[model samples]
Target: MSSSVGPGDGSANRDAEFTETLKSVAGMANLTQSRQVIREIGSSVIQCAHDRTVSIIVARQVLDGLAGKLRSSGSDDTAEADAVVDIADYLLREINAQGQSSNLVDQTVGLCEVAATAFETKEEYTEAAQRLASIPLDESRRRVSPEDKVRVWIRIVRDYLEVDDSTAAEPYLNKAKGAIFDVNDAELNLHFKLSQARINDAKREFLAASASYHDISFSPKLAEEERLHTLTMAVRCAVLAPAGPSRARALGRLYKDERSVMLANDFSILEKMFLNRLLQPKEIKEFAETLQPHQLATTADGSTVLERAVIEHNLLGVSLVYNNIPIASLANLLGLSNDEAKTEAVAARMIEQGRLVGRIDQLKGMVWFEGGEASGQNGSGKTAAPVDKELRYWGANVQSLAEEVERVTAELQKQFPGFVEANLVV
Candidate 1:
């Protein structure tokens, strides 16, 4: 009484379906329609041969025909979209089962790439990443060029980033990093750098993320709007960075950037933070609205990252305006509660960490500001001290320092091999 046919009967019907499909495709007047119909075959009836190898050979020919042939037009055709994904997945399982065939592998790459694009368009990023990851990077089977591999891995990183999966994205990003230099395409390299920035941002390495975003903002290859958008992102990351000499220097670079002026909302906060001006609750609230969910994430201190950054930044701001302030009073000024001990602890930590450039007088319940117009961590009137801020690092995971070191080494290796080899490790 079951409606489902037995396996043998179903196989016969599928085989018949495949035979008729090819005939219908051969007689078709429109090449695009023929291709679209074929696009659905692997998902539906490509298994008609019953032999996995034979089916792959047939499916590969159809996919190869799809190569160099564009879709010609967009469609909301959900059925066609679903079929495209199914085709890729079918190839995926067969590829795993069968040993690598050079011809099949080559065509599989193209079809999988197309399927990945379809997934991305539908905003199914995890599926897109998996589709891209399934591509065979084994050079023994086929030629896998550096740029080609970088393109795929970077695309995977971008997909994982889209879904807020940094852990998943990191390995693919590292894969791309190894091949990025060999890629001559500026756009691809730009995206590689952007992906790194995105991961750092997700990981709360704001200083590092800001530096990359700031550098990218100056790329001449970017359109004006795109450049400005990156500039905006740079400012946000910089503002969210920890209050210290390194962060101060990073903020200075963005503040000095001419393009930063184009983004009024971002520029306003940038100016205030760079000048060490106290931020109001209203202003902070408005600026907070512009940040991404990750940017607004909570820290171990039970405060949003934005809240922590602002409080610490305001502490530095107040330090510049006053020679000394009581701990209770400092708490109120920093928008914290009437908790003098907690306020004093924050000051003490910043001073110990060389961020506040001050001395906390616990007995007197006062923080003696060391920077001026009050005194001068050189936390003073605008412009940071003309020192080599590039070498400064916060701690173990300061990603910016490593990146900056690499840039300098790459430049130095161009002309000074001895210095690079002796002092720097690539």
Candidate 2:
């Protein structure tokens, strides 16, 4: 009972015990273990392949285990494919050892998913598209489900849109359209329409494009905020459509309904110009004389404040005598500087406004007011002063001034008889 083992005996016994434990565990477990265990084993297998005979068997086990894990995960197919690619180089090395072409084919075709995973990482969409295209349709139909195909097409379309080559993208667009229409899902349909709208815009088919744009406006599948954007595109297309007169009319009606003061004034000015060009000189003169005296005043001061009025009236008279020479040239005759001439011209504009005249025109060098009234003043009974001596001295002769004013007044009355009574005189 007092027996004691030596150091060598104790070492031998420990070795025996360790060997037995290894044997039991090795027999109890399958060739491949859990995913975590398999991953570790796969790493070891890669390391062992550098120098050990068990490398091929270990790599095979790792691949089988990883494939099983991928199948069970049911979601993360891409990640699963990526895991397979991690082992591809080792697998290829072993397959090369076999010296069989069929072995190479079997290995490559078996890991199509892995190839896809690696190809996608290249970020060359054209290459990915080519690889995907090379996979037998039947094999893809069996291996990747319809839902996966839809996802793939979505990715392809996104990539194609980035490239922005309409010719190269047409087939992808067609494929996406088919996938969208074939699927009965409302969400997918809306996505399809959105893509179609983009493609249609690229193709320059605005009418067909608008239809797709309109679909997204009320699509329940799209977010409310996104639907607003879609609605905007539809409205834009409707406004820009070149084919339909109805659309043009509708836009015109909307604009007219929303008329602002600025827009209304522009229209009024334009209409008066059109009518002025259409009417004869006698009619134009009649229209000018019909204006109230105060309407023609340069300032709001009473009619007797004659200097500003004379300056204004004489400016008009100079325009008539000099064939409506610009105010800058008239300024030169009056010995005023450019800025002074511009100021004088602007003052003349104020007088025209007071008279409710639309515009001043120089016909054959003589200036005439297009929509001027006879009284030449506003409702306050103010009248412009007679032609100033200074103005007459500056190349504006009395005879020419009187004749021009008379002629313009006659034209105004001829065009509008009662217009002068209604708007011009007190």
Candidate 3:
């Protein structure tokens, strides 16, 4: 009679074979061959698990075989899990070990799914997030650009927001803002703008949302779809702003223009409806600054007047020795003839008097005056009496210029206190 080996002995032999095969493949320097061998071993283990005829001993052998494959270079967690799903309890211990390893993302993610299906727990979801975070963000210009950093940040913010963790979300949103400007691609910029608008809208900061929309609308590099969406947001914000005189005018202007109408119809409907009411005085100021002088003049009323040209001559000699029109541009604006405009003549006289001392290259075609105060002498030094007169005249002119500037600045402050604060005059 021959001594026959038991099922446990055969299972142990198979397990030893699987382990030896895995060790051989892992030790090989050729990655491709090792992967092929691992796959073959994994398939055989999975087949054994599916065979019910195999005893618990055989099942253990199969699991051990799958785990050995997992340790191999080409072995993945999903494959390992699939091969041993029948023995989840046994697999759980192995899964935890794999999850803790640096090279176990595929296995961890697979384990997460299995764990979620088999056992629902808060830790599972947390583990899933952690495993997902571990995957290095693929760096590619076409697919996952640097601009996607903002999108990732925004997604994180939304997740945090869902948990009512606004404090945590705020930093993510701020990071998104900083990332948006760093992107070079125009298409990405439009996406960033839209994301910002959505975030602002969710925060109920409609004005900021509207401004973001406006930026998208006027973006020179944005795609057509992005531009349309941006215009829509602008129109919507305009309507949502207060319906005062300024808002009404802005809405009327936006509606009358072809670009505005195109944007109004294509962008969000809610934005269009609220566009007129969202207009801020600061927005109006920004818009006004971009317009030409003629455009601004055309919109002026009885209280408005064209701004006077900046005269760069001494105030004393301005009326007498020099012409009323100081420069060619000023002369043209004032509707004076070339001869009547003594800009050049006055400049020449100043040069002779040493009041305007500079290189001929600097004074080739224009008058360049230096202040008498900058000449390094007081009134009593040279040409004593005339110097005193010059000093007194300059002092009065400076005082007068200061008063005028102060008055204009005060008026600007009343009209736009926020603007004045941001742009304090030196």
Candidate 4:
């Protein structure tokens, strides 16, 4: 009653049925259905390969078919996109185990790009960048040109920065630099320069960053908005730079630029006011009020720029007039509160940095400028009456000691003439 179909016949029938099912799945208009088909194919491939020792050629066909379905599914659907990545992972393993293919490297790279795009869409920027970097650039069969290699390297730099890892970006940037040689592309060069500037800024080398921004701003090929933005950044860097003539020069250049007028802020005005020799403490205070919290240096008391400026100004003002003043009076002149703690904090900074040469006496409530006449006198600020008894006794003791030293030297010379000539202690 039973008719036997041979083992080979049953296997052939199953394979033909699978091929037909794959074709039908490929033709389905619904993306969700298409993903289900790919998943089914994956399951069948694994099952058949284990039970019947499916040939590598058949496995390759199934993989290629799955990739085709994935391409048709598009990237917008999360389920379909993840399925594509899963299939790519399987294909990669198969290709690695079964030996290389002429087209496999390209296919692998394509899959990695897809995976990276998916990760990027999810805001997993670090993983996305890593996926792109895993491409086999050194493969002899890789068809990517020198320029494309540089592009890849540049992307790595950007990715590293997205995660705020400049230390990691640096090696990749160097690789990009090496790859860019002999590549005569202006746009790529600009991007490289911009990335370099950003890296410098992230590293807190504002002066170097300003120089880079200045260079990029002058490029005729850049857009007007971008050029102006770069110039504004350069101005900020110049302002933030340690006070020096170069900072003055940078600010001067920014002030003279017509483009700077377009920036709607007090940055330029602040820079100008800070540089003027005749600028008063009141003007500095007025300008300081306009800056945002981030623009000023912070202390335990408050965010203050004018505090430091007024302190320096008062020190200079007093240096020009009265070099000797009580600490309380100095505090009052600098517009500081009567609190000696606040006064000492401000004055100590200037004196410690050698910007002011002075000494403070907290107990006596006095400050003595190095060159002031009061410095040579006692704290009463009056010269002592001439030669007290105690002072004369000290002077006599010093004179007697000097006379005894001279007599001892003469006696030594008389006793040992050659010894004195050869080994005289000066």
Best by TM-score: 1
lDDT for 213 in candidate 1 is: 90
Computed on alpha carbons, the lDDT of every model, listed in order, comes to: 0.73, 0.44, 0.44, 0.63
Q: 1-426 in candidate 2: lDDT tens per residue?
A: 211223344434433443343334334233223334444443444443333323343344444444334333333345544444444434544544544223224233344444444545544456545545443334422455555556556555655655554556567667766556456667656666677776765665545665667656777777866775665454434333321223333234323432212333323322333222222234334433433232233444432222332333334334334433554565554333454534345434444334323232222222233323323333211234322123424545767789898898788889997886677653
* After superposition, candidate 2 runs with Cα above 4 Å error: 1-128, 140-147, 176-181, 245-426
**TM-score for each of the candidates:** 0.74, 0.35, 0.31, 0.56
Better of 2 and 3 by TM-score: 2
Between candidates 1 and 3, the lDDT winner: 1
Ranking by lDDT: 1, 4, 2, 3
lDDT of 2 at 278: 25
393: Cα error in model 2, Å: 63
CA error at residue 112 for candidate 2, angstroms: 6.9
- Model 1 superposed RMSD (Cα): 16.2
lDDT of 1 by residue, 1-426 (tens): 222334454444544555555555545444434544554554443343234323444555554544323232224565555655654555555544544345467866776787787687678999989988988897477888899899899999999999999999999998887788789999999999999999999999999999999889889989989888888998999999988788888989988887788898888999999998888899899999999999999888688999989988999888878888888899999888887866776765566555766566555667777543222244332224221122122333467778898788788999998977898743
Q: Top lDDT: which candidate number?
A: 1
**Candidate with better TM-score, 1 vs 3:** 1
